[model samples]
Target: MTEQGQSMLNRTVRKRHQLSAESIAKDLQISCGLQISITAVRRELHGMGLHKRAAACKPYITKCNAKRQMQ
Candidate 1:
């Protein structure tokens, strides 16, 4: 694992929440002098066990009429 690359990605991601793999690659190129591709960045992020996800708000279904269905 590239600690330097990962640190750079973490810092940039923390500062700019919308930064993606492509952005991270560019930032690393400009700041750390490392030439990287989006796919490589994405793979590294995955290897680090970081994934993108959204919170889901779901309603419960607990009012069904069981007796009525039996009839």
Candidate 2:
């Protein structure tokens, strides 16, 4: 990744920490028109001191669901 691309990736991760390599690659392609491989993205991220992390799965509780659970 170029310096600009790296900065873009850094900013992106800062804004949303839950992004995967595949999604980040796709976003770069769509937004920056940069055709990069998933492995390349991973390598660049690793070079930038970023690593893979699994997002925590949390169920969304609507008001109705919250009320039902409280019963």
Candidate 1: lDDT over CA atoms?
A: 0.75
Q: What do the candidate models score in CA lDDT, each in turn?
A: 0.75, 0.84
Show pairs that collide, candidate 1: none
Cα lDDT tens digits for candidate 1, 1-71: 37877788777777777547887888889987988888988887777666666659975544476555666
Best by lDDT: 2
Candidate 2, residues 1-71, lDDT tens digits: the string is: 68888888887778777558999888888887889899988998899877777669999999999999999
Worst 10 residues of 1 by lDDT: 59-68
Q: Quote the lDDT for 41 in model 1.
A: 82
Best model number under TM-score: 2
Candidate 2: segments with Cα more than 4 A from true spot: 54-71
Off by over 4 Å in 1: 59-71
Can you give the TM-score per candidate against the true fold?
0.62, 0.66
